[model samples]
Target: MPARTYPALSYELYPPRGDDAEESLWATIRRLEDTRPDFVSVTYGAAGSNRETALTLLRRLLTETALKPLAHLTCVGSSRAELTDVVERLIGGGVRGILALRGDAPDGVDPSEGDLQHAEDLVRLIRHIEAPRTAQLAAGRVSVGVAAYATRHPDSPSEEHDIDVLLAKQQAGADFAITQVFFQPADYARLLTRARRAGVTIPIIPGVMPLTSTRRVEKLGSLAGIEVDASLLARLEGARSDAERRRTGVAATVELARAALDHGAPGLHLYTFNEHAAALDVLDALGLERPPEAGTVASL
Candidate 1:
């Protein structure tokens, strides 16, 4: 295969909750547009709390931006019928790709509340979904992706079980997998090794998040069942100011990105947290935001 001319870059965004926040989000989107990510995704809330918001963002992205939007559909609190309706809405809105997920249950609720039990089930549904009469299905069908956990998912029985779930997703029709954010690239490597051994051949992209807020990132990581490197945390905590800490975080992200690509990972799926400055800075530092050559797949 020929070497890639430019690295593949993608971003994740969450819907804004209020007027001020919405304004901020647009500004971020505008800035990110300049960087020209391969695609951008909007996250669905846990238990489907923000499904409409996510849909609206996707629609606006299709019309208002140059970015390709990936809609996230989760089996959080939706029945099979309801899930189908959501997919129809996306197709109607011209979304060409979806990230199928088994999202987190709302606080104090049971995960079993949803009709679709697993990511694999959602993936299968998306693969064979019949488009509603009102909508235009992009490219005849939507491209589907599923999440991968470098470490064990919080609800998974073990690491092996989580890997099995990912393999099942591929069998169910996922075109690729984007891993949860992890501190160590080695964890992603281990996950990929196990996946390949299990006969999974689809692209698996490493999710990268630049740590700007030490406390907030740690808390979020813990909630997602991600392991933190103690020494790394200690180093961040040692920074005398927020600026210094962010600089350290950016440096670390660049290092991690290099490791993932060097290890044969397909690309970087950055968790932008609805912000773009830090992620853009990291990409610029890594010299990965340039345009790809013609005929290149732009995945590296």
Candidate 2:
């Protein structure tokens, strides 16, 4: 289970929307628990919508399961006081990692009006809040994670600018980074090249797109501001039945994952939109169905 030998694994999940969704999500959580991923990230809503439900889910993950939760905290439409409170709550609840983000603009709101304008600022703020509590923390500091873009972010001026932004986050105390969903291994290779050239030394985990179906890839890929991989989509479209489609999608993703590992990716971060089947399928195909025995892939 050495880091060089076996990459770390993680998942992205969102808060369950309703009672039925919660039950189904819990089932998925249980199944995922069996694999013992290094950590599971629970996404926050844009501008803190559904904040309570997200916190409740994180709380349950802390109490009822052995899984470590990485709480996503967005700075859009929130004040410093609010974010400080949220950080405090996360620490008090035994959470160690946070994915700090400058969330996308909500309806009728200007993105620039937020108290924290950049993810770097939020990273500094989290470190500032956690400084005094170092004595109580058994794992050293709160492991702050920030988003990295393999493709140019919609708000970015250039890919070089994205690399600069990532460097700034690292300077601001970010422990590591997880990339936004990318379609091809080349995209990741290019980003890593830019980052290393710019002196960004933190580990960057690839966010594996859940190519469970053609429709899911198109819709979520668009929403994430990444175009769907035409090659992967065409394969999904060529499948004659639902089962065949699932197999096709999983196979394409496995190839992408394998390519990423070959390129020296630290680990894979599979986006599970509250379903475990496809994510598990991709992991099993990668021969990572069981968690590593003695080492943590994500050591942050």
Candidate 3:
């Protein structure tokens, strides 16, 4: 049989908190492996709060699984030298891809304290780093990915400014971008229209985070800097119980994913929040249950 593949689908996971959580995370990883995502990304918590744990998980994924793991690097609370060390460590650890981020300021930490100011700056840094391991260089040196904002970035004054930021990162050698979770397909289209007008040609995958719970949608929206569609929000809010809310979330996410794919989104980058069932259900419903044919989608 042909190697299993996915229709350009990817999943995001976060580092676990303890040994038990690590075992659970491995189980989740194994479960998702059957989906054969193009790649899976692991997030470093805000301000590099989970750096060690994230790196540990990345190394484990590299050694223990066939999954391609992309390590997230942030410029929130580290100096340039500190970040350089982290980059070197990743290369030494056999990881080949990175997601450069200007992570949110950790609680009670001023954002200005970091030496690397913007994610674009970190993108530049990653592009220039020399890998210590020849094997890592052969693995493709360092494929740098950056974040894109489908809705305007939280700190950006306008959507145009947000596109410009992404354009700058592309110029700095970002391989591709993954957007923050967004519900409206039009939001992604508008962002892409502006980006293309500005000459950004890199793939921008739409991020999909299922609502999961009506009560948490508002907080999720706020954190992602996205606006929940009023009608969808109403449907979710009107759910009478936890199970009903979850069903509404899954159904709504499936609809949103269909709309996004219909609008020519390159692919979907799911924010799994370390949970796979809802996201897997949404993908299965969309007729993407089988692996994608070879050469149909770009490799990570």
Candidate 4:
């Protein structure tokens, strides 16, 4: 059969710590699963500290539910051999897709000595594994995806340079890209145009993070280099109570999702931040319910 296509809805999850965290994560997973997300992803902790936990969670999902899991793999502080071993392990575990990254350095570590600097380098390395056995070991084929910045990357001098870097990753064999979260729909529209101009044709999914609280949203925006638009900033600033801010935030996220889909974003990738209620509320507002199967969805 031809490959299926759907307006994808995906969520990102982080590795949990103890009993409470694990319970909360499962609760969130079930809540999101009810919406029939296209896929559910689990993140690797800083320096891959939770790599094993992520793997365990992937196994749990595979055995318990029908959700396809995308494990986030980072290159920081890992040698090529180390990454190859991890890839081999995931393949053996039946995981078929990865979100490759050159992760942020752990605090106080000098980044220059790391084995992988750019995500494209990781993509190139994975590509090598898919080559002939005489050249390298085959880890079976894995769908490789990379991160993109809809707004200018914090380290980039200009948006053009950022798009160029993303295009390089796509050329290096990244199958798709998931963007950093942004509040403004226009930013993603412009970024998509720039990427196409730079000749990157892969599906670019727009990342969305529901703002549960004003303070938390502001802090996240500062860290990600997203300029909370003046109008949004004003609305949040003016909200007299926490309830008002949350209401406004949900409204804003729903509006943003509508605009993104209108602009042809291939899908919506939500940063769950280990919570589901707000994200579910936003998805409901967009009229996006869960899929019958994990990754495929029926038409509205």
Candidate 5:
């Protein structure tokens, strides 16, 4: 038999907020570039917030680095026209893939939602608009990725509903999905089982991150509406110093990633949080990901 194929390794980054942060992020970007990730995703704020900053980073990545850029566009608090413009800008800037998301709507804002009500709606829109730009694309099509949930979405009534939504997105033309940050290996396995049983065929990549501190994991759990691992929290809290805490965190993350890969996850999509140390440490520890041989598929 031929050697077993592992899925691609990718990373997620967000736009930096200020000049100092921008400088720091560039340093991290350079370091991550050396890893030759299959694709590096950039997140724009909800309702097209931080649009310019995100655009600048994408443009720089295209020109300054050898990495492929996967731009993130969220459907929330923006009109159809606004979304059309953003999509055009990304296409014109040579972005070949987008991760569609139905982001959180702002509080106290009436009509805080966009014309695109769900991620599936955004998927349809992306396919429809990109139809006219096929000649400019090297692959002759856009690769649109959506988010999958291993746990119940905060607003969703049940896990089955979330799987149904994912099915709808795939039907609407999403090529793949990267799940929200999940803590347990069993979480990813359960999601894959449910999704396959529901007829969702897209390759769903597990999004892993290095939770290097008590506050980092707590904040991510709160934001993603997922439960934090209490034992991992306790371990970090009991660490003798910041360095020890990071060591514990990275070790826990390596175990999580290894288990997911062992469970047959299609790929590893790491959340870099605009910093690279812990993420790199996790990569080094797992040693599961490597550069794909030439002419092989490097991404899911």
Candidate 6:
């Protein structure tokens, strides 16, 4: 049999807050770009708080490098007209891909009346914007991606129900799916199988967030609904020092990536958490090297 195809490795980034933030982000970006990711995505703040800054960073990436940039767009507080405008703006700025989401509602606002309640709605809107009728003003067929949760969504009553919702989003026009970060490779494998069974045929990239700090890992686990394996948690708890914890975390992540690759995962989606050292260390442990030049995909 031919070599199994793995999904391309990529990463998610958030826009910076100020000069210091910008400097830090740029440094991280440079390190990640050296790895030659398949693509790098820039996230938008909740309720579109960082819309302009996100766009500016996206444009900079487009102009300054050859890397394919994916922009995250959420329909949390904006109207259909506003979303359409934002889509148009991104296309006008030469962005060809988007990660669509139903972001958290603005502070103090009830989510029920939010402008966009679901990701499928945003996917549909993007499809409409890319239609031939609007093709004259827009780039042709922008690639739309949607998020998936390996573990049940925090608000979801059941994992099956979440998979069904993901399938519906794919049918509605999402080109691909990127899952929430999970520590165990098995969780991702099972989740992918369940999603396929639920009729979600798009590529489901497993998201991996390395635990660089125990406190941060615990916080992220709570937020993402990832069940930290008791054994690993115990190992972390037994660590004698902060450095030991970080080292153990890197080793754990490396093992997870190896298992994922062996089990036929399409690709790894790393959550850098705006820090590069831990991710870089994990990549090194996995024997993955940076792409030779800018915008090139890293090879196994």
Question: What's the lDDT for all of these models?
Answer: 0.84, 0.88, 0.83, 0.83, 0.88, 0.84
Flag the better candidate by TM-score, 4 or 5: 5
Q: Output candidate 6 Cα RMSD.
A: 3.1
lDDT tens per residue, model 5, 1-300? 556665689999999999999999999999998888899999978677688999999999999999999999988777889889889999988888899998876666444456878889888999989987777675488899999998988889999999999999999999999999888868989999999999998999999889797887999899879889899999999999989999999998888788878888877999988899999999888886576756887554
TM per candidate: 0.91, 0.94, 0.89, 0.90, 0.94, 0.90
**Local accuracy of candidate 4 as per-residue lDDT tens digits, 33-94:** 87777788889875677889998998898889778899899988777788888877776677
Steric clash pairs (candidate 2): none
List where candidate 6 sits over 4 angstroms from the true fold. Answer: 1-7, 133-140, 289-300
**Mind giving the per-residue lDDT tens digits that candidate 2 earns over 177-229?**
99988888688889989999999999999898768677878887787678777
lDDT of 1 by residue, 126-161 (tens): 766743432454336677889998888888899889
Off by over 4 Å in 4: 1-5, 130-140, 240-242, 289-300
TM-score order, best first, reads 5, 2, 1, 6, 4, 3
lDDT of 3 by residue, 156-243 (tens): 8998888889989999889899988787757777777788899999988888888776556788888767777788888887889977
Give the poorly placed runs of model 1, Cα more than 4 Å off: 1-5, 130-139, 292-300
Cα lDDT, model 3, residue 143: 77
Model 4 local distance difference test score: 0.83
lDDT of 3 at 68: 92
lDDT of 3 at 277: 80
| Backbone clashes in model 6 | 3
